[model samples]
Target: MKYYQKALYDEMTSFYLITCDDEGDKLGRIRSLIGGLVRKARQVIGQEGDDKVRIHQLLQLFYGDWGFHCDPEHYFEAENLYLAYVLETHSGMPVSLGALLLYLADSLKLPLYPVNFPTQLILRAEVDNEVAFIDPWNGHYLSQAHLQKLYEGAFGFGAEISSEELERADVNTLLNRFRQLAKNALIRENRNDAAYRYIASLLRYHPEDPYEIRDRGLVLAQMGCYQAAAEDLQYFVDQCPQDPTSFLLTAQLAELKDHFSELH
Candidate 1:
């Protein structure tokens, strides 16, 4: 997580290097780590087979021998989202685990990418010249027919799945998912300051994201930064004038500013 310098935090930028444009220390370290994993996976899979066989072997090595799966013990743990910790523990949430194995696949020359599943993170890979939607968290290959059922289970029983649901996720989308994971956990645990930091990072990448701006304002208010909170809330209200919560946000912004005035 950005190579700690006397700071102890679970929130990290180590995974952020994967989507980074420029070559820097964090990106280089990430490359080195992924390279090692790819080399290890190659040793397990060997080079005697075609792409299909290699992909199968790669899955077996990661999901079987490596025993990498979702962290059933601690589902919301921040360490589960940290790449280095996930690699070491061999357990993580869907996005973290999926991205790690996906990186290895990319390094190994396998045509694999992440799918922006509406409910959860998954992977898409080419196997036998066909697309195999993978539930990387469990190492299961999901078929088209079964996708609807999985979607129903995740979203709701009556919900319908469409072809457009299988869209690819971009780098920023992936990073935003990572940030939200930590943000949700921090807010849930009442760590408002840390949550504010996480949401601030998210807003930096997604400046116009209304919900993030709204939530960041709420987080700041909880952390006693009333003026800053009021500013963010006002910005959200102004930028998203038609927002469903605009009236509520206006009320909150006024209250936040009043608190700031009283304190000052």
Candidate 2:
């Protein structure tokens, strides 16, 4: 099932009891809040009528109070700030704030799309099919060039990356981001347990990724699970014959009599 479907189902179930008892009042309040928040957001953007402003301007109004902190890791902090602002400034419900923003923008015929970026909760707006990324915390609009520079600094300039790579980041990407976080924590603390959790998460998200399979094999080998490591390495080699690491691991496994030669 799609992630949003599951989320909608859960939401409906939670409010089912309230709806049953006071359907009219419940819906009326929801509509009122949505209408009010939409008007407020539009006013903040200095937009008259339905004319759309840049995505960055929307973000800036959303988080204008917070000073400049552009790091991706500060996403949760930004979310919290927005939540507090909604409650204090607009008398909005916390449970519906994110949904309201998404819905209201659509209602206003805006081009906003929810972005599940790596280690961040953000939104994007498309104009002429080109996406402009929005940071909800400081309300900064991040350009494609900005994203490219950020990736180059982190992953090296030779790394080939594009906005298309970020266009449809789904549950798998979320799992990978969480796994990366766990791996970073492991590196900082030198904890085997943390590393194991990351490996497990990576496998769960991409059971068929050859690189992940090889990584799991390496972890197993380190844990002295030679038999299991051999099996994984054998599978990796079977799936990707061109990988040198897989071939080397397969040869090592063969010496231990755990390699299945026919598989390769």
Candidate 3:
């Protein structure tokens, strides 16, 4: 495997292993699953040298035969962010699906790379030295116009999809984006303990991130750990004293202190 691919795989697997105990066995199963996918792709993809043809065949195997697609109704569910659950259910949000699709494309020797597109995860494909976009939610190809429409839809119609925005996401960038989505999903569902664990798992990558510290504090507060929450919020306030949200968190910090005193 190339260095970039190996690094990405390691980061993805390690992130998942944070939650589960049976690491080796689970990794083995995931490898077996990828192997099965590769075998199936070979059977259908044939000896095609054309990148586009191979991409199409791989898409057929994945979305058509494997039934992997986004479940819009349950898009925000925490299960949609994990690879194991995504593989089993064949349904995931764009980030999870895009990561798996990117890995599959690489295994099949297709020139697919992750695009950390705003509000949507996508893939950038290079075929015959020409760059194009593919929506990992479905196999549909994306034109620049379509990309503009998506950007406008997400951020309102004025700003365009900049060249920088279409640049390929590096391993850490991709992993962090996916992790953030998973954490947000957990928080939205009021799964405070799970959110806390998820944040702890990701903290190693960004030990001193004030945003994460503040979020962890909020999650702790939700779980009734007022003292810990107070400490965290205080850290955030200290780190970012001028931030607008710091004012609100300062108020919350007082309440947490009050609660801590009551419990004491």
Model 3 over residues 103-129: C-alpha lDDT tens digits? 777667778888788878788888887
The residue-level lDDT of candidate 3 at 54 comes to 84
Worst 10 contiguous positions by lDDT, candidate 1? 1-10
Question: Model 1 over residues 156-220: C-alpha lDDT tens digits?
Answer: 89788776668656656555666667777667677675566566666677788878987888788
- What's the distance in Å from true for residue 39, model 1? 2.0
Measured over all alpha carbons after superposition, the RMSD of each candidate to the real structure, in angstroms, is 6.7, 10.9, 2.5
Q: What C-alpha lDDT values do all the predictions have?
A: 0.71, 0.51, 0.79
Off by over 4 Å in 1: 1-35, 154-158, 190-212, 245-264
Selected candidate, larger lDDT, 2 vs 3: 3
TM-scores for all predictions: 0.76, 0.42, 0.89
The runs of at least 3 residues in candidate 2 whose Cα sits more than 4 Å from the true structure, single-residue gaps closed, are 1-58, 61-123, 127-131, 135-139, 144-189, 201-209, 221-227, 244-264
Candidate 2 lDDT, 147-206, residue by residue in tens: 667667767887655656667446445334434443444434444443555566556757
Off by over 4 Å in 3: 1-10, 21-25, 46-48
- TM-score of decoy 3: 0.89
